[model samples]
Target chain A: MNPPVYFFTDFSSRGPYLGQMESAVLAVAPQARIINLMNDAPFANPRASACLLAALNDYLPENAVVVAVVDPGVGGSRKAICLNIGDRWYLGPDNGLLSLLVSNAGAENCSLAGLHESYMKAASASFHGRDVFAPVAGLLVNGQSPDTFPLPVDGMAGASWPGELAEVIYLDGFGNAMTGLRMRNLRDLQGVVVGGQLVKPAYTFSSVPAGALFCYENSLGLLEIAANGSNAGRILGLEIGSPVNPHISPGRSKNP
Target chain B: MNPPVYFFTDFSSRGPYLGQMESAVLAVAPQARIINLMNDAPFANPRASACLLAALNDYLPENAVVVAVVDPGVGGSRKAICLNIGDRWYLGPDNGLLSLLVSNAGAENCSLAGLHESYMKAASASFHGRDVFAPVAGLLVNGQSPDTFPLPVDGMAGASWPGELAEVIYLDGFGNAMTGLRMRNLRDLQGVVVGGQLVKPAYTFSSVPAGALFCYENSLGLLEIAANGSNAGRILGLEIGSPVNPHISPGRSKNP
Candidate 1:
């Protein structure tokens, strides 16, 4: 059996876009397993989303094909590309959405290639996620390589972008604010300050007083601001692109 | 190959509940195709949810197994049951969640049964969707029958509930309010009044002026109130359980 195909897109969960893309995958690989890894990514902000996407790398198994689409330039001149990073494959627009993942994997560990021209010819102007990326993923999981031309890492968009973002990149259902800064890189920090509030670190919600604001490393290992037993995002007035500053003690230096 | 497993639950899209339940289905039937039919069902209001579920019946294919989990009575004395309605199978708590679907299929066409005792014994108090319903669905799709006892139609909760509900039951990603009233059943009505605003019927969004509120039959065949390119739900302040009263001319009477 083929490996599962995972979708990570800015398409909100309630729309028909996700379902249409799933149908496009099934059209090519009828027996393939599909998972909606994350449908509610930071909308149309690829630079910020790249950091969150990299944090979710541990969830993708070897041989899995991930269709990452946060393209605001969908109908523009942005090139469609595929990247072979580690044992998994990523099919998406050449915009900065996949750049952070590629940079994290290092140049030697990544192979970048432009998707075949035929896909673009057949794709609709606005919805390349359903038209281009999803079908490419289906074919990849079916063990058939879509035609492609090799591209240099330097030519990729957002190749020089920062590895981490200090903004709230996502808000989960419970209204917890997930920042793009990885916890591993911020080990020296005691907490984060958001919306003029000092949010201290806690192991979990239960470890803190109910309704108290706290920050912790979420399952994806990102620093997330949450309120125990309450809507932290609403209480703190946090939204996508909200700034989050590291709170380090006077004696402790930030991660260098 | 087994039929696909569809999940209809109140679990919001951003949480771990949906993903964990998907994992459980894969564990039992490794090759089964899982689709998230609907994750954001009206939270804990299965009576309202039943009307929405019955409207979505057209999406299910023959032999498909749907795990309906709008369960608020979890860990309670409510019975776990399975219903073979039409050619599709449904596994959920007997807390009126699946009652409308069963009634829609007619009593003679439905076969209601209690799930095997072993499933209940092993299921966690909080999440039977993962432990009980998901595994039972996987077993059915794989052609293995879990133990069950026959049940009469009258034994089902909400079995005698109204065929249609005239309240806002769901809101889609675009904030369009979806009422439980089916459009087919209200052909004689020119429009409906929601939140004290008169909403006229139109074929689609483009037919009306931009930002104008109008009602139409959504793809699911239910009455939905939408603005041309804006959020009608937000503008009108409509939410789940908001009453919708049909507006008919003096010559026209309500559906009989």
Candidate 2:
């Protein structure tokens, strides 16, 4: 059986864009399980969203097909591409949004390809999420090989980007701040410094007192700034791309 | 075949709450097609959310099970109920959130019922969406009959409420404001007076010039206020539950 398809985009709340995307997918694979992983990706900031998409990779079900769209340059000269990382499939614009995913998947095991522009020849130039990428995702979920629609180029535009990012990537509804820094390798780290505030690491929300600010490994397996019973985003004045400094206590090794 | 399940809630944009609801549904029916209709419903205001949920009902597929949650009174004396409106199933709190649906379905065809509270005895008093409603929806989707889980009452708490509402029930991501008035019975209606501004109607976004405010039938088949190229919600300072007075043109009969 084909794995479920996960949709990640910047469509945010409201509008017909998200629903139309689902319709396009259902028209092809009527029974496919589609998950709206996150619709509120940092708007138009694909670099920040790239880190978010990478950090979210750990929470996805096995062999999921993720159709990610954080494209600010949709109708322009940017290419439309797909990447097959092991059993998982990633589809979206050729912007740097897929950089971290490709880098984390170990570029050696992944192959990048693109679709024919003719597929979207009739689509509105402004709404490619509904017209172009959704249909492409529908086709992929039906077991079509990415190599069947090859691009003129070999690698994605941002394939050479770094593996980990240190900036604030996303802010959740609860005001928790998620940084691009992976929690995999950090050892003996005392706290995270955001806006000059030292937030100590706790095991979970209940580990800290109500209204207390702290840092912890979130369900997505990344270091997130959170308050036990309040909105951390509002208190910290955090935003996408905000600089987050991971404070390592003296004599602690920086390497994982 | 079971129709897809649509999720409407006030969970906002982040947290494990919404995802955990999907997990509960998928656990019972692994291949269930779950759609996140909207998560940012008006917080805690079920009357306003009921109007929004009612307006959204037209856009849902046939026989779709909607697990609507806008319960501000969770873990209180409020009841958890389900309504079978034709082929569609609506499940959530008894705080008038499903009132519009029951009223629209004409009450007689819709029989009110509730699940045994023992099903939720193990559930956190806070999140019945994950523990109770989702599991019930999964059972219904897998062909369990509504008659199997009957409530003590025959009618919903808000069954006798008005069919049409004249309030701003929801605001979309594009900054459009959606009212609770259904367009089906609005004949000879020229415009809507919102915040003391009389906005005219247009066929589509392009029908008016840029930054023009107009009321039209939205994708959800409800009257909505929108700006051609600008944010209408920002321009009009509109919000959920904002009073909107519908203007029926003089000398035009009010008949449908």
Candidate 3:
């Protein structure tokens, strides 16, 4: 479509593919805008990375080529992938670091970048963020033929990540902290346990007594845990980099 | 709620109102968890403050109070407000600051606190973010009466505030500085005409050929002006803490 484009990399603990990706983008599509989405999720947690990926549609520029990398199962037996969903393309490990985007992007076709002799670079250990993912994305951004670099396959052993992590990604002006918990989860609080304490009767901050702990849907539509006139993060020991855990309620349907 | 809450306020920006507002919460509710929401929105332009508001929703605790203080017309003539949107309540000025949320919060039955004698903690000449808005929001969290503190007005004034401001706000890691452009006010093929030099379109570091000029959308979804391979903030002779005048497309609409 000849629109502006960028690369959104996850520079989490896995680090970044800045040099190679930058080189690839500069080598060809030098006119396309390139950006680093983020490389700061947890270590080797594809699910967490996926959660971040889900927020992309709402916050990222539409039509931008998002090349993300949060692969924990780097190297080894894992498979690298390029997934085209709707009008967008995502190049990363097929380990569901992109699973977070399933509900939104809806993968149309996924091809595995088989580690053949010509496909991969002479890389180092645990540095795929720089060596592999970055170059692949930049090459794609430059409109290079995908088949020119690597062959397509199916199924790479994805990483196993299971946790109810709702972190405070940012805070608002009015003192409202927006968590990773979306509106769907907040409105359906069944069995919520924060800091060894059970959150009962989840509702508005004002729904209960003044001092009572309350859980409700924040303006951004996420489930937030708060109290009237008190600091929930400090009092509950939930810091800026902490994750929220949502326990499964017994005898309840998963869907709300 | 009993969750940890943190606000991104600066020291002295909210001043006693921050603690006092927290105190107001404890005065009645006695057990509200109040965290520090930042008291800095680059002089508290409600529109500038609007960006902080949205970001906080992404990274805030499940339930917390964010206290922002970007009020320029603090004690002038603007009215304090509280919005009961979805599950969270936002407290701030009526002027277009919360304009972004009016449609989402069901502006029809939205709530506002009338000017109160008791809740007015001897407000300063121009520090509503510290004196008024903070304390009232604190009381709301502290389990105090929302209607008791102030009278409810239909809504605040200045719904359309485009072409009113004259500066830049936040910047990105790429040094692609985001201007205070109201999103809708940008036009196509609009050249950057600052000080008579026509800005060149350098999509990436290479396209600029000399890394002199670049333009693109920053990570925060705002149109940005940047310099390749160099800090545009420095090269362009602009400072993040300062302001700038941007050239917009004539047909661009203004954000409310």
Candidate 4:
């Protein structure tokens, strides 16, 4: 059986880009199981997006092929690459969108390679997500190996970037702000400081008063700020790349 | 081979609803080909949504199953329904959401039925889209005849609604406003009067000046208002259900 293909891109759901990419995948793998893991990743910021990708890594199914594309530098000199991390595969531009996940998996457990020349040659410079990465992911899911050569992990862009990012990486439809900071990365946190407001943490929305701003570990295990029964992002004036300072309790460092 | 399942709903891409519904579909039809046709339908306004759905009918592949849920009356007295329109199957609430398409198909080519009680009993009250409609769609796609009974098309809700709606039904991510009025419904139209501005009809965005509002037939064949390089919806303050007036040329009726 062919494995499922997950799409994580900066392509907003409104346009034809998401649908066109899926069609490209289905063109190669006729019966492939496809899912839109995320179409609203932070547009153009690979560092914050890398952290978000790593946080969502645990939710991916075994033997899945992920097409991760947050490329703002499309049609540029960025190389198209694929990485075999654990049992899953990731195909995208080697512009640090996959760096955090690769770093977390350790170099030995991850093998990186550039995509074959044939796939890249026929692709349009502006839409590699559809022309290149999608087809490569479909080929990988169908158990066909694309031509590639091994590459050193350290040479990847953003390889030396910090492990955690303390900024808003995404804002969901419900107006919840998802930061790049993971729940496990902090200890004894009192609250988070954002937009000059002290937003306390809560386990769930109902635990706090209505319209109250609070931070919590969301389903993806990322530190998310939300407002009970209201739009937290709007109320707190937070947007993608907004700075967030975790207020750790006294006698403890911010990061473990 | 199982038919592809297309999801069209108001469930924005941000939350887990769309993914959960897809998961429910895959649970029943493990090998099903799923596509998110549209997840940002006008929230809770099925009248405008119905017109939008009818406009998108031409894009569905033959033998495809559509799970459309813009149901504001979900889990209420509304009945879960399935409509066999032409070669495709539509599964959703029996509200006016399906009325426009049913009416457009000439009741003779359409067949209506109520979902099986077994599926409804097993579903949660608030999320019939995920619990009930999704699984039934899976069954239909897998060549399994789900238990359903015949119903009269004339008795369905919204059966008496108009064929065309002269209102903004959707605002895409690009800030373009899509009206429920089809392009074919107009004749020798000079411009559309929306928000007290005369948006001249243009063949494409390039034909108009940058940031100039223009109306054109979008990819879906709907009359859409857009700016050359700016957001027309934001500039014109058009939202779902916003009234749109079409200015036909002299001596011609508004509707052809």
Candidate 5:
């Protein structure tokens, strides 16, 4: 890892605090490989997060620490956990992020997934990614055990109520791309977004009419806008961090 | 332009010749931008060249002369011309490339879209982008006239034609992107290429359910192959410059 620590999050909260944590990593690790695994993970969908992780797991640097925070129940009784599974370590709220991995193991094998209170930093009502998750992840990457921070909290279930999956993270030039949406949720939708500003009219940029607004399942399996003769990005007036408000017909599953 | 003289072509026939011409541009016009539009244009489609032109049109420096070559009916009775539309000049065969620009302006109303013969190299074939086009574009950037060389071929009609609309060109890592095929040509596709492999399902490293092959429009919007859990690039065995066959789907049409 050229850059030792890799932090992944939805960037929902923790502004300068995140930056400060990054600075701490810089000072200590000095060689962190901070791969951005989509700061736009949907509000709180383990599937979306899992999909993203599933998509990127094979490509991440070997044995790199993957820190993700998609907590909607940040300051509740939810227990923050550190898990070691399949040669990788995950530190975050014991949300459903590990469900896929655990399910894959089939035998319910356990390997160091515990939440400790000693690591809590004032336990703010929100912002665990900055206060708890980031710091614990930093320590874990340096070869410290999950217990190095805290003892496993008992009877504290995480945010795992499989819900409606919604997300629109990245928009690229040609207005033909929007990455990070769960395609499984949108594949059946005949919906419109942005008050019909973005509509799924065709399958790809080619299928969409020129100068007409159209949506499709981009290879990323996310919603995207495109123009046959021009760029979708300029047309929609969006850049890296623009939010997508998709309006679907027949609506989505409320939670995929 | 920091680099002068751009080359966009398949270059199957005029590779070394264009290389010499490019060297000549840098040797002669160091202050100019010598961009590689491409050496991997599809067989013969002026619209493909046009898509490439548009993709780079906005990012180019003022007065930059873009040199392109997609001459299939080269030695045939096609006329050679240089078109000055908007703020830049395009030096290539007077084929449908300029026609693709019809959405903006007609080729007949060119500012300096004329022919020059005196600057032509002796014993040159119809592949002028190398011997004729590249040198001429370089000369103009080096400060010369539209008439310093040859007279416009009298009655050389730059008439229009109707075909697939060219929109974007691929920009590969080595500066060679297999572009020129518009989205109109890529829809409902079963398999295409990247790093020289037949690709289908688009999967992410982790999302891939172990041993699944993945194919998707890479970050660059060109078809790419990636494994969900492994390096498909290494597993399926591909490297840069390998052919990515984005074959025309059975339902492909000549329209967008």
Candidate 6:
């Protein structure tokens, strides 16, 4: 059975961009199962998108082919690459979008850089996510080998980036704020301080009262600030890449 | 060959909700091609979603299984249904969400009233999209027949609703405003009167200068108001369900 293909992009699902990308993939791999992991990744901010992708990676199927393109650098000199991180495979650009995933996968992971010039030459000046990466991803999920296509590399382009960022990486449609810090980092933390408001930890949204701002472990295993039945992003004046300071409760054990 | 499944919903793609729904479908139909046709449908406005779904249907493949849920009346006594419109199949609540599709497909179409009580009985109070529709859609694309599930009906609920809604049904992430009126309805129309601004028609965004407000036949064949390379929704003061008046240019032929 073919592993499902997941699409993660900053391409907002407006216009015909996303549809054209999906058509390109289906044209090559007709029998493939495609899941749109996200199309609304933060626009043009690859650094923020990288952290969101890493946090969201837990939900993606292991060994699946992921086509990630948060590329603000399309049509530029940026290299198109593929990464084989453990069992999962990713086809995207080298613009730091896949950095966290590659870095987190550790020493055993490998990247194949420089998509064929012939493929890039024929790709649209603006939409490589559709013309170039989609076909490459389609071919890969249909069983093409990385060695047969690109130059292999031991390190990814942005693999040297930080393990965890202190900035808000994504704000969902419901106004929940997803930070770069992992939930595992909250062992000694009692809450989050954002927009001049100190919010406490809750197990889930239901644990907090309506309109109450709270921090909780989201399903993505990230520290997220949300309001019960409300828009926390609007309430706390948070946006993508907003700086957040985690607060440690007095007497809380760091290792607990 | 299994038919592709498309999800058209008001359920914002923010949390684990959409992911969990996808997991349910994949659990049953592991090889299914699932497309997020639109996750950000106008919330709780099934009338608007119905129009948007109808306009968007032109892009979906025939015989596809579409799980459309815009039920503001979820957990209420509203009936869950299955509609066989031509070769396409739709599973959703009967609260006008699928009405446009049903009405547009004409008399040859058929509907199955009342999803099995056992299915609805097990559904969560607030999320029938995951509990009832997802599993049902999975079984369907995997070859289960509508005949084995529910009672047949000649007419669907809300099928008598108007063909065109002169209001904004959705605002895409790019801030383009998609009206419920199809371009076909504007035979004599020269422009639209939206937010007291007379917006003229253009072929494409690039046809006009940057920040110039214009209306065009979008890929979905709907009259979408956009500003060249700018946020149209913000500039025009338009949002989901905002009303607009179509005006005819004097001396212009209606047939044009």
Collision pairs in model 2:
none
lDDT of 4 by residue, B1-256 (tens): 6789999998787744676577678767778888889988887788998998988887888888999998565546678999998778999998789999888889999999998778778665446887899889889878888899899999988999998889999999899999988888788989999988988999999999888899999998889999998999999999998899998889988775
Worst 10 residues of 4 chain A by lDDT: A55-64
TM per candidate: 0.61, 0.61, 0.43, 0.61, 0.38, 0.62
Candidate 5 local distance difference test against the native: 0.53
Which of the two, 4 or 5, has more DockQ? 4
C-alpha RMSD by candidate, in order? 7.7, 7.8, 18.4, 7.5, 23.5, 8.0
What tens digits encode model 5's per-residue C-alpha lDDT throughout A53-127? 544443343465777777767788766777665667777777666444443343235354566787675656677
- Cα-based RMSD of candidate 1: 7.7
- After superposition, candidate 4 runs with Cα above 4 Å error: A14-16, A252-256, B1-9, B14-28, B33-38, B41-256
Tell me the whole-model lDDT of each prediction, alpha carbons only. Answer: 0.85, 0.79, 0.51, 0.85, 0.53, 0.79
How many clashes show up in model 6? Answer: 0
Per-residue lDDT for A44-140 in model 4, tens only?
A: 8888788888877765666778899998889888888999986899998889998898778887788999987787789898999999998888788
In angstroms, the error of model 4 at A72 is: 3.3
lDDT of 1 by residue, B131-185 (tens): 7988888788788888998888778999889889999999888989999888877
DockQ, model 1, C-alpha based: 0.11
Q: Per-residue lDDT for B72-185 in model 2, tens only?
A: 889887778888878989889888888888767775777678777677678889999999899888888898764336653335666667777788888878788888887766
lDDT of 5 at A187: 47
Off by over 4 Å in 5: A1-4, A12-14, A44-51, A97-112, A121-125, A148-256, B1-256
The DockQ of each candidate is 0.11, 0.11, 0.03, 0.13, 0.02, 0.11
Tens digits of lDDT, candidate 5, B30-54: 3455666566664355655565455
Interface root-mean-square deviation for each candidate?
6.2, 5.7, 16.8, 6.1, 17.5, 5.7
Model 3: per-residue lDDT, tens digit, A120-231?
5576667665566555655666666464334433233332333234665433223333356675743345645665566554445445564566555643345566655445
Instruction: Point out the higher-scoring one by lDDT: 2 or 4.
Output: 4
Candidate 4 falls in which docking quality class? incorrect
